[model samples]
Target: MKRLGVLLISLSVIACQSEKKTTGQTDSTNAGTTSSSLTYKYDSLQVFSKTTTAIDKGKADTAYAKIVYPIFSNEQLNQLVEKKAIDAAGDVDSEKPKTYKEMAASFVEGFDSVNGEPDMGQPGAWFLDDQTKVLVSQPDYLCLEHSNVSYAGGAHPNSAMVFWNFDPKTLKEITLESLIKEGGLPELNAIAEKIFRKNEKLSPTASLKDSYFFEKDTFSLNRNFTITKEGLKFLYNPYEIKAYAYGSTELLIPFSELKALAKPNTLLSPTP
Candidate 1:
């Protein structure tokens, strides 16, 4: 189980950098001066291995990992992205992997080492498929989505999806608190709960205690949200607010509903 944890963490780190094509273009105008726009590209890393044993005469245990992440022109932004990816992947020890390639290698090596143990019982081949993509690329915000499916000798494979938002100009993470006005969270949550009920087709006054996992039968907004052209999109992954069998739930709160709660000059603010 410990090795399984390591494999999960390492694979997630490697999954942050997969290959994708992107181009940078400059807009021209009648004026002599030019304004440059920010752009990014992507690269990928992969590692795989299998273990050999003399027991069953050809059933080898295998491990594989793949990762894709974006590369920005700005070095500061690049470093920040790398740091965030590593952090989100989960820490192992003081001497953790420093790059995506190393992370992939670590995952493969960990699985192979565990398989080589003399008394270890054969479970099955293990694999990790991870992908990270630019979900939304706008002038003010950049949203990244990381998703992965993995099996580590558990009862069943697991899948997860995560989103990260960043401020392009400042290279800072765009937190929900940063976009909302002070004392506006209550109103925002109320609006979001209403929409959530509508999306789930639940009556407005329905009790959540029986069917949902809210702490006190009250709905609340989570930080796992992304900014989209249509609205603020939130994702509740499997087992997050419901049983794993229920899968994920998506809630999109329109920008119009959040206009009063949004702070001025932020991405959610309406243009004049």
Candidate 2:
């Protein structure tokens, strides 16, 4: 089941301000004689700052950040999620940030340092909005999806989406290799290419050289995928396999089609 929505309340002070919000939920399910449950919570951290000169001139030379991430009952899982969330929020400094607050503060501080000088003639405000949500939670696997959008005086904003699958019991990241049998990627890629071609309305023998960005115009599956009730859904973020104008692409391959490739007793196994 899905979690509750976040309640946002912004507070302002002088030229810089910070705020936070939190929401949570619990879910349960039954299998024959056994029962299972999971509890998930989310918190949002936001920070905003603007250059004094821009503030005086009524122009916007600002830096802002907002991150919504999960808080799990398991400490190790929490740490892993936090680190990945911070990385997704654009932690480009030499020293990595340990927490959301540090990540946001460093973002604003970098803006201040660069725009603090007089007559900097900055173009526009910079922002990073990163959010993580539960996509699927089961007894064996839990998947979290992260969506991000940001801009720093560019012609257009940049966006990305990523999925993180975890072993619920071990709290460790799950890889596509573990889900598929040995020497199965070739067959899987063939299946995905057929679906992709149909989805894009490209002919069977059409060339991808000039129209797409795949290496040597070859089609392959990326690791950015999540588990769904019907199938495995893969995502190709903007500029991943095509130009930004084309936006993202999604391909859903049903479990029935993957019966031969999927390993036994894994998340990809078809439910009885």
Candidate 3:
């Protein structure tokens, strides 16, 4: 359990670079640039790359990919840096009320919402308090996270956030299941509508997804990945992988491609 929290906070944010020296070769598979010597390409993934029969028959991969692709491919770090968004993502102790450590602790507390319960059996369940942790919209983003936290339990192809990252400080395990998309306010419907329309379905998995509007305007791209039966390995691992963002229309990114997007100054965690 201790190691699990580490997994969730695994991606540690790095210090900002004082001077921006544009170097290194951006990969062609990366969908970000069109003018570079190495251009990336993406054949629009049909709603049913795996299925030829039903629209809803396919996993939420395309819906997930649609948003994720642009985030990774089109993110202009320079723009973000110029606007000082990157520094804000990890605003550190400079924030108003709580310190970074305190804020992180508060997040854990809200996650479990029942951290006091120690004897709970594996203490796991989807969308249920005993089993999920969430990644809510950031300070300036309208994102939210929720999950069943059990790809093992889904046993099905479709799975959202269902992973764990052990946090030793709390001495409790945190699973990726609580971050939901429930409407924060009526206005949030606009965000949900986009997700719904783009998804071409309503309530795809019943997990509560929150408004990511703040993220949409704040970032150029968003990325997320989930490990299901879709060819990646997860069993006996006690962890899962996923990324998400809310930004520009064309900046959606996939998990497979996101690994390449990691910048030197980007937050990274100790690989579990």
Encode model 1's per-residue lDDT on 1-272: one tens digit a residue.
33545655655554443423224332331111112255566666667663543347566667777777766667787677776666666647556666766656665666666776655444666776667777777777778898867676656777778898887777688999999999999999999999999888999999999889988889998899998879999999887888888999999999889888889999889878
Q: Model-by-model lDDT, in order?
A: 0.73, 0.74, 0.25
Give the root-mean-square deviation of each candidate in angstroms: 6.6, 7.5, 21.1
Ranking by TM-score: 2, 1, 3
lDDT of 3: 0.25
> Which portions of model 1 miss their true places by more than 4 Å?
1-36, 52-59, 91-94, 116-122
lDDT by residue for model 2 over 154-187, one digit each (tens)?
5788899999998787777899899899999899
TM-score of each: 0.80, 0.83, 0.17
lDDT of 2 at 190: 96
lDDT of 2 at 235: 97
lDDT of 1: 0.73
Q: lDDT per residue, candidate 3, 1-272, as tens digits?
A: 22334323421321111111113344554333322221222222111011111224452211111111112232342232112221222323333212222222322322233332444223223121111212221222111122221111223222333232222222132222221222322332334344444553434444333433333332111123222222111221111211233211222222343233222221221123
Q: Of models 1 and 2, which has the larger lDDT? A: 2
